[model samples]
Target: MAGMPSAHSSGDSRAPGTERDGGTWVVIPLFNESSVIAGVIEGLLEVVEHVVCVDDGSTDGSAEIAEAAGARVVRHPYNLGQGAALQTGIGYAREQPGAEFIVTFDADGQHRVVDALAMVALAREEDAAIVFGSRFLDDRTRPGLLKKAVLKTAVWVTNLTTGLTLTDAHNGLRVIRIDAARAVNLKQDRMAHATEIVLQLGRTGLPYREFPVEVLYTEYSRAKGQSLLNSINILVDLVIN
Candidate 1:
């Protein structure tokens, strides 16, 4: 774990079960998502008490929009990829006063706001270090044929490499305990970081679970860069690295 600290080591100062509220913070990583980030932030604010948005060197005014929408904004000077953005956001969450749990959400309007409650509740109830949102658990939300094929391949490869049996391995909407996140380091900067996170979690033997999540594949998200090819690139990155 290059980016994450050791789990058994006690680097984080927050004591377990010390916080009274057990508050959760939502972290959204955005890159040139000026059109949709505002709405995502507003929707998340309705449910979560704290929201942090990491602007990954977006040329567009994403940081301004996120700040105006009431999310604490962190900006990367250059495009460091989603993994770096997520790490930055998690670091911010760790610095917050009462951040017991952290949730990663997409700014491209794919994840639903209501799902956060279930993720948080499940983490608390099960004491799971990581709770991933699975779209394939329910067949109704399966993506297109090509996309589905890519996801299935990803699931297989992830299982082979990481030994974690996940129904939806590449889902962005995930809730994780702050301590667990701080423990598992993520070094990959590109899209492959998603797989890297899961792999690291498995290696550390962290407890995890998955729950059904709604997936809304809008034309905007599809057009903005989340294509089936990105999955291939992610795999390539994993292999090459």
Candidate 2:
């Protein structure tokens, strides 16, 4: 909700519902992902018309490449964590006309558009406020043993703390109705935001479901993704903050 006012208060003529039924915006929070963001946006545009990429102060030309790939790029003056970038993109999507739904996607190219489309379709069919993707529910995704163990532990901890029984608490792929989108206020500004989202939903008591989805962990994602130390830090941050 922090960035929602700027979209209108700035006196922009393009109000929310500018696209009517086509108001589904895929929000991708990007870092120094110039190497992969173009292809990511290209694939997302194939399914959804409005793709908002928030560049979290990437030194690389990520914003330019994303804009060239047909994404509306929002830039941060400095490096904010993934959580802050997501909040910015989500707020922008909220102000779009006919923006009925919003999807949180990764710029690492690990997420599949087919999965996102499935979540979007599910959101419409069930009238669910939120639909989250779970890699553990599907057999197609093969995470490394260590990664699997860490994430499984994370899911358990999140469920225990948030009091929600979600199989995949931290999976990035998620779809939410406009109401749920407006209600999600993230403050962690880092990997901790994943947990924060669940916590917020628990407090709001929004309807949520988990759908099985596939994740392709190539060398790039595995190398650039969260590490064991980062995971530990996330737990500490969640507890302290």
Encode model 2's per-residue lDDT on 85-125: one tens digit a residue: 99999988887866788999999999999899889888888
Residue range 1-241, candidate 1, lDDT tens digits: 1123322211223334433123777889989999999899777766555678899999988899888887778899999999999888887777666568889999899998878778888988998988989999887585888888888888889889999899887889999887787765678888888889888877768899999998888888777646776786887789886
Collision count of model 1: 1
Worst lDDT run of 10 residues, candidate 2, spans 2-11
Q: Where does candidate 1 have its weakest 10-residue lDDT segment?
A: 1-10
lDDT of each: 0.80, 0.84
Candidate 1 residue pairs in clash (backbone atoms < 3 Å): 4-185
TM-score of each: 0.87, 0.90
The CA lDDT at 210 in model 2 is 88
Mark the regions of model 1 whose C-alpha exceeds 4 Å error after superposition: 1-22
Q: Report the C-alpha displacement of residue 159, candidate 1, in angstroms.
A: 1.2
lDDT of 2 at 10: 20
